[model samples]
Target chain A: MRAYGFRVPGGFHATHTYEAVEAAERIGYPVVMKIVSPDVVHKSDLGGVRLNISTAQGVRDAFDLMMLRINQRLPDARIEGIYVEKMVSKGLEIIIGMSRDPQFGPMLMFGLGGVFVEVMKDVTFYIAPITHDEAMQMLMSTRSYKMLVGARGQQGVDLKAIATGLQRISQLSTDFPQIAELDINPFIVGEFGTDPVAADVRMALQSPED
Target chain B: MLEPLLYPKTIAVVGASKKPGKVGHEILANLIKGGFTGKIIPVNPTADQVLDLPCYKSPVDCGESIDLSLIVVPNRAVVEAVKSSIKAGAGAIVVITAGFKEIGEEGAALEREVAEICVSHGVRLLGPNCLGLINTENRMNASFGGDIPMAGGVSVISQSGALCTAILDTAAGLNLGLAKLFSIGNKADVSEVDLLRVLGRDEQTKVIVGYLEDITSGDDFIKAATEASTIKPVIILKSGTTVAGLKAASSHTGVLAGADTAYGAAFMRSGVIRAENYEDLFDFATAFAIQPLPKGDRVLIITNAGGPGTMAADAVENAGMRVMSLDRNVATALKSKLPAAASVGNPIDVLGDADPDRYLAALEAAQEDDSVDAVIVILTPQAMTRPVETARAIVVGCQKGDKTVLASFMGGRGVLPGRDALAAAGLPQYYSPERAVAALKAMHDYAAWKRRPPRIVARFRVNTRRVERIITRCLRANRRQLG
Candidate 1:
């Protein structure tokens, strides 16, 4: 996504505790740390994620603790390395995703992330690649659109930036037929001019035999 | 590709029979009675004559080249019939035979074999287990679905033959005219996409209606439907919307991306008006065919009673349309013409006892108001209410304006004459306020869709080579699931 000009947080991979400290100092804290393994699909579920590590010593401790938790939980999970990244501030949480529909090639999905999406199922979809206007319409079609427009006197997030992000993802999905399903959950969006960051991403590819 | 199927110059009933109750005999009889101007040749080995037309032993023996062949033979002999028809220079084929594809694997294979022959010869095929088609433009009633429909602007396409008959019945009852109708059974060769493209280009059709059990290809449907919808309103009623074709995945989007949702998104993107039920399909078709598109969503209601006026207001709001307060000038104009007991707000209630003149006054004022995009005239039969006269008044006031009008004559026997009058004047009248409101909303949405900005998909400078390399490397390593 970053290759397609999407805003993503800076991060580095470190295999050892000393390397983790060095990478954190270079990237600057407060930062987030997580276990990087092909086996551990959901890092936070396995207690493999740590946040608000503001210093080099904090990064060292968080990395060791996350690894220890993952090893104890899975027992046989492969631990590739530790991922350290800059932490974005509190912002509105939105999810942007793509699922390659067998009939229609690629469908882009949008919703307010977390409980709103899980409980209410307030989501909308559009076939990609969509125009920027279509992306905006997709966002407004949801029941949670008022929340994005700043409900109860709260500040509204940068909606144009979100539309642009959606366009980029739509292009990405159209460009790569190998990508079967993708999700950028909690794409943290801040007020007005602030750029939204893709906090976490997951993508799946079509089976080789297919 | 479908020219011969829709406008055949010469048609051959391949299984034409002497027996009246037989499928072949009814189809041949329908062709003669429906007033098809072209030559109708019946092909049957056992009969020399059918319904006064000379019968040929086979299509190969028909002497003249056949533009279309309607086959209604037994299941086992369908393939041979199609082959002989194609051999006799038939441009298109409509197999009215049953027990193919809808039966089982053996039937499906036979259907495929027949389709393969049609494809190899470049001849279009309509169905192997379906009802035939109708074209009112040429006075051709090729189907055995009974009488030839009155020629009008609305055309229909349905997957189920029974639904086609029901639509035909409803259309006749409602006095809605039709241009062309097709029953695409099994869709072995020609599907909705092909018909959409053809009908979208057809000048005689103003509105296209469809009933589909399933679409053959989603991408092709979007392309064809989008093109058709841009030309005119394409209303469809699609059933079988269960959560089929879902894949187990790790994301919320993947879990929620079912067949129904994808179809919904596709329809939205392509600008197709989706009808919720059988009634909605005709209601929408009636509105689109008879009335001009509303320029905006603001609706003005004119009624003879308070309850129906209020009902119209509530229905308008519920349909996402605005029952806006009347413009000040229009309100002032209505006040002077109406009785003192009448209210001249959004629902300009011209009292329960008011007659045709009061409706004429309110409708005239609404016609000149630029802010009101549509008008709904509701009438309830009262002791002194003139249903027929008031309906005529509405026709006179609304006939010349850009603003479209829909009427809701809210009673059965009392409003029959008035509803017929409105129908004759090419104005859509509904049974109730809710139905009228639904139709008006459909027009509003289609107008808005037409007024939307041109679609421009942004194409960025993408790294195609890198994406190709990554995909190739993953597939080569047998790593289908990647992060």
Candidate 2:
């Protein structure tokens, strides 16, 4: 996805403990670690995700624990190595996604992420390859639009960054008809002047028959 | 040119019947009664004559080149009739036969085969289950429908044949004119987009009115409508939307984006004016078909009754248009000319006893005001009012102004003649104040659409080779929608 010029979190893949330590050093302290495997679907539930690992020793230990847990729980799962990414905690979380509509081709979706997403379910959509004004309208149409606008004394996120992220996904959606569904859940959006990052992403392509 | 299809020089009525109540007989009768001057040949296997016209055994046996073929044959004979028409060099074919695609799988297969044949030959096919079409300019009533509108500027395309007849009847009753009316039933070969493409180039059509149940192809429609709307206003009354019944599976964005969003976005992008309800279609059709595009959002209400006048003002505000306070000079001019009891403000009530002269003065005042973009003349037929005279005055008032006017002649019977006259004069007159205001707002919205900046669709660089490779694999696997 980063190859598409979408802003992903500063991250690296590591196969060994020494590489994990190297990755931590390169990304700096207070990093996040994740178990990368083909079979694992519920990462947090399977103790695959670890956040805020400060030292090089912490990174190595976390990587080893993840491998051991994976080996114990799901022996057939491929040990694809661990992921080390810079932890972004301060900014707001939003979801930007795309799914091909049967009649309308690719369509974009945007809204707030996390627990409230299920509870309130405020979102909006625009058919992809959306223009700047169209992207802006999508953000404004959502129920969580106030959050993006900075309600009360709270600071608003960089909406342009988010819109840009959405526009990139839109272009991707149009460019590749094969991508059946995609999601950038919890895209951490920084302050007005700061850049938003695609913290986690998933792309689901359709089967040949479908 | 749509000459062969819409303005054909001759027609062969296939399956032309001598029976009075049959579909074939009615179509042939309608063609003759409609004053179509072109040569009309009847195709019948049995009868020597159908409604006094010489009957040929089939289209192939017609000898003279057939321009249009109206097939009113049974399901089984339609294919043969179409082949015969093609052999006779027919440019277009209107299959008025049912049982194809409307019945079941066997019918769908039959329709598909017919559609394939039409596509291969590039024949302009209207329907396998429809009332066919009518072109008023050519004075052709190829359909069995009874209502044939007066010749004018609005071109109509309907999805349902039943709705097409109903709409034509309504238009006839209201004295609305039509340049072209097509009932594109099933739209197997030629869809709404195809009609829009043709209508876009029609010099006679000023406004395009469509009743669409579903868009056959969204991208094609967008492209066609965008081109059409740039030249002439396209007003569509799109119905049959199944609201977002799909639960939010992965994200909330899925929930917010309803089933209707695609249609709404497409309309917005293409500059197609969408009428919200069933009746709003005619309201918009009347406005775009007859009146000028309003210059701005400022509206002035001139009325005989204060209550209806106030209601019109409220509707104007609700429609996101402002009711303009009278210009000082215009207000002064109105005050000096009118009675002391009358109001000279936004809802310029001329009093119930006011007649044609008063309406003429108010309409002219609003027209002359720089702040007023459009005017809505509201009337409640009072005992003292002369409806016909006032209607004539309103028509004259419209002729003198650049700004468009919408009329609300509220009530039954007493104001029916006035409404009738206004409609005949091609002035959009609604039964309610709200309807008039709605039309006014549509005018304002259309103006806004015209003024909107052209959207620039941005292109971004991606790994084309990788994308191409993936697509190649998908295609190799015989997959259109890939994972």
Candidate 3:
């Protein structure tokens, strides 16, 4: 999560369409608008996301539509605010997470992200906190490592950047023991020379118990 | 300590019975038959004597300290029996009754009571449903199981008494020796961690083989095993070692990060050989029992058949061992000595019809190859092949060694005699080339582990507070991320 020094899309939210347009202009064009709330876990599934808005008018209009649709979809749903962020167009999606296993202590997981992740789940696990070399091994051991390394004419991503991101997550969990379940989905790993960024992150805190 | 638990000076069979088929009677009989010179006392309320040993109404009435007590009373009477054993100042107790834990909530509560009693009394309890423990040093057959096991360096600690007996029978057949065998059922007080740490210090134990179903918490055990592997090999065969990489879940690493993944990491970090299956467990133990660790990673596969040799080559490579190319001189010598049909490659097949003498010539070539760290000799049942003679020749060639050698006598009826020869020579042998390669791989892995430097974990403090503040700002601004 951005709160944990993990890279995330940059943009700002505003109260009105005018403020939304102004915020989009300040952040640059091609922003994504989504309904942000404490209640909603899956915003896209609720038709609460508007993507790739290139113009200020596009950001303003999309923000209004997103809020209206979310309100109409769930009449009882409490609206927290609207989230606007710069859209990431070029990158392969990957997922990284950590879950504290009662028996095994802290465990970290890595795998390919996107829709096909469920159809063809390719993932691996390691006990936290993993070193840079081990993080690299976890990345390379996955089925998508070849794609990350640029196979079949597809462009390669900066593996070190992603490995470093994983290591940072490792450090984050180590630093914050209260985190029980963490999911950083669709960590957009850009083509060579570009830093990989975590697009979405959700963490569930561990409830205190014996 | 383990002295009273393992080499007890006086043992009491709490539920001693006159009946032949009863567990108490059988344990009493096994002790006498095992030639245990230590005093064996029987405890029973009604019986005058059991197995000709004078009986006491209870351990409390024994009027002397009991080093170890084997409690085989009924489920209802176990707690009372254990308390009396504790009252008699028993240092260790092996409860042989089974109603505890395995029978569910009430039984688990009962087991907990037993554990609490043992801890409060400062006593070590082996099991509530165990076959019992054996001390090869004292020739003590404390279990109701069969004949006294042979005394040797390997120590077996198993959670399952049935599996322990099976392994004992197998070890007996293979002429393997054991320093101790513990059927640590339900581990009420002493778990694998306690035994591993204790046995790591026991001089009689050179290798430890553990069969466990679960490992709940083992940071101390990992540290102990890591220290133990510094001097001896610890081979473990864990039941239900699930591959975390196969579990389907919402997270990408769900499968790879399952519960069992921790065990794998623990073993790797501690430098223990975790056998993939039962056969691997046996093979690895047998290799460690018979052979020395390989000097290096280079392995040479010499066989009579090309196919099996290549299969072994692939296996060796898969096991992360290299089949190094022989030196020019060694290859030339092999080329000239081997028949025209032979190949002088890494496998260095000596032709199918090659006899024991041909095997010797190749074995000699392997020994001469400076790059060859270990040799796996494969023999097929060819018409002209003399399997036993080849085995003897291979053993002879391996005798002049700094390098270790293993034999693979492939086939059933025809290779049995040769396999026996290899076994009789105290040389490790397998029925298949891959099995042989696996044994060699174990040797290589042990060597590699021994060579690994002391582990040091470098921790980096990444400042998440700055990231947290930025994220909080974004959340208030309704922005979650940016490219």
Candidate 4:
């Protein structure tokens, strides 16, 4: 995703406590650690995620504690390692994704992260390989567009950042047909010209026969 | 390639029959009654002759350069009939036979086999389960569905044969003319995409209408529909949504991408006007077929009754269009020409007792106003109202300008003459003000789509090599899904 120009946080996989501490130091203090496993989804729910670990000792302890809890909860799961990364600042939560339509090929989707998508289903879609104008139109089509523009005198986030993220996802989905479905939940975005972070990513691949 | 299918000079009915009410018999009779100039050979194995024409045992025995062969044989013999038609030098085929794909796996396999044979022979097939097709330009009614439609610019394609009949009946009742009609059942080879391109280039077709349950391919459909919509209006009434593709969804994105969402997106991007129901299909078609495309979204309502005028105003507002207030000079001109009781606002109420001349005066003023792009004239049955004369005045008022004018003569028995007069002048008349406004909204939206600048999709610089490597590694590890 970073290769496609999306602003992903600095991160690396670490298999041991020493490696986790060193990676956290390399990324600088005030970092986050998440369990790296293909079998385990919802890392936060599984207690496999720790945030705001400002010290090297804190990174070491968080890594050991996350591994122990994950191991106890999901004994059959295969743990790839732990992911140490820089913690991004707070911003408006938005979701950008791509799901290959059985008929239309790649389709890009946009909506606010929480209730707008989960409960209201207030989302809009456009076929992949969309233009900048189309990406902007997709955002404006959603019922929650005013939220991104700052409703009720609140500070609005950078709309171009979200649109660019959608365009990049479109390009990625078009480039890699095997990447069938992808979701960048909580794509934290700030005001205009400010880079947004793809804080978490979930992706799936097309089965061989399909 | 589809010229032969749509404009065949010679046709052969492979399952021609002798009994009344039979599919084959009705098709042959309709062809003859439709006054087709081309030779129509009836091929029946059992009968020596049918409908007083020399019937051959098969299309193969006919020994003619058959441009199109209409097959209505039983399901088991459909493949054989198609094979024989191909052997007889059939350029195209239309299999009206049912029981393919819609029945079961066995039927689907049989349909595929028939399609394969056509493909191997380089022949285009219309249907293995359809209502056949009709070309009014060639004066041919090659389907067993119904009578020949009146010839005009609106062409229709339907996925449902039953809906095709309903559309035909409605068109006939409404006196709407059709250029061509195809019931693309089971779209084994010639799908809606193929027909869209064909109709898009057809000289006689000004409006393309469709009744689709589902599209063959979404990407191809968007491409074809986009192109066709550029040439002329394409109105589609799509119904039904199946969750067949959502069962394997593993992500929230996949789950949110419902069965119908993609279709909606595709339609919007393609500039195709989606009609919400059967009525909308023809209403929009007729509006596009006859009325000029509005240059702007500003509309002026001219009505005899204030209530219907307000209804029209509400409908226009709800559709995101403007019931624009006339300018000061235009309002002054209208007030001078109209009665003192008439309100000169957006809904220019000419009063309940208004006659043809008052309606004409308001219409003329609206047409001359630069802010008004369209005008909806509504009339109700009153003691002094003249339905027929008011309709004629509307026709004459709109005859000089490019401004679009529609009507809503809101009564069943009393407004028939007015509606008939509007129909005669090729003016679209709805039964209610809201319906008229809805049709106007469709026209405005289509005009907006056409006015948009050409789409230029941006291609970003990306590391494709790395993507390929990652996908290859994942698949090599037998992990079909990656997190």
Q: Which candidate's lDDT is highest?
A: 4
What is the per-residue lDDT of model 4 for residues B83-157, given as tens digits with 9 covering 90 to 100? 999998998999999999999999999999999999999999998789989999989999887889999889999
Docking class of 3: acceptable
CAPRI-style quality class for the chain A–B interface of candidate 4: medium
Query: What TM-score do all the candidates reach, one by one?
Result: 0.95, 0.85, 0.90, 0.93
Candidate 4 lDDT over residue span A46-154, tens digit each: 9988988999889888988999999999998999999998998678988998888888888899999988899999999898889888899999888898898998988
Per-residue lDDT tens digits for candidate 3, residues B1-483, read 677888888999999989999998899999999999798999999998887778999997877888999999998899999999988889999999899999999999999999999998889999989999888889999998788898888899999999988989988877778999999999888888888888888899988999998764666767777888888899998777543433434333443365477677677667789898888878888888878788988888888888888888899898778887789888987888878888888888888789888889888888877898988888889898998899899888987766788888888999888888887777888878899888788778778778865444446555677755654554566543221
Tens digit of per-residue lDDT, candidate 1, span B426-455: 788899999999999888888888889999
Global lDDT of each candidate: 0.88, 0.84, 0.81, 0.89
The candidates, ranked best first by lDDT, are: 4, 1, 2, 3
True contacts kept of each: 0.63, 0.27, 0.22, 0.74
Which residue segments of model 4 deviate by more than 4 Å?
A12-32, A50-69, A207-209, B60-63, B242-245, B479-483
* Candidate 3, A1-210: lDDT as tens digits: 655556688878677788788878887878878786766656788887788889977877788788887788887776767777888878898888786665555677777886546667677767677778777878877778888889899888888877777777777777766555577787888877787777777665542341
Considering only chain A, what is the TM-score of each predicted structure?
Answer: 0.93, 0.90, 0.91, 0.91
* Candidate 2: stretches off by over 4 Å: A11-94, A110-124, A137-159, A188-191, A207-209, B241-258, B304-314, B339-342, B351-354, B381-386, B460-483
Q: Per TM-score, what order, best first?
A: 1, 4, 3, 2
Task: Indicate the DockQ of the complex predicted as candidate 3.
Answer: 0.30
- Cα distance off (Å), candidate 2, residue B89: 2.2
- All candidates' chain B TM-scores are 0.95, 0.93, 0.91, 0.95
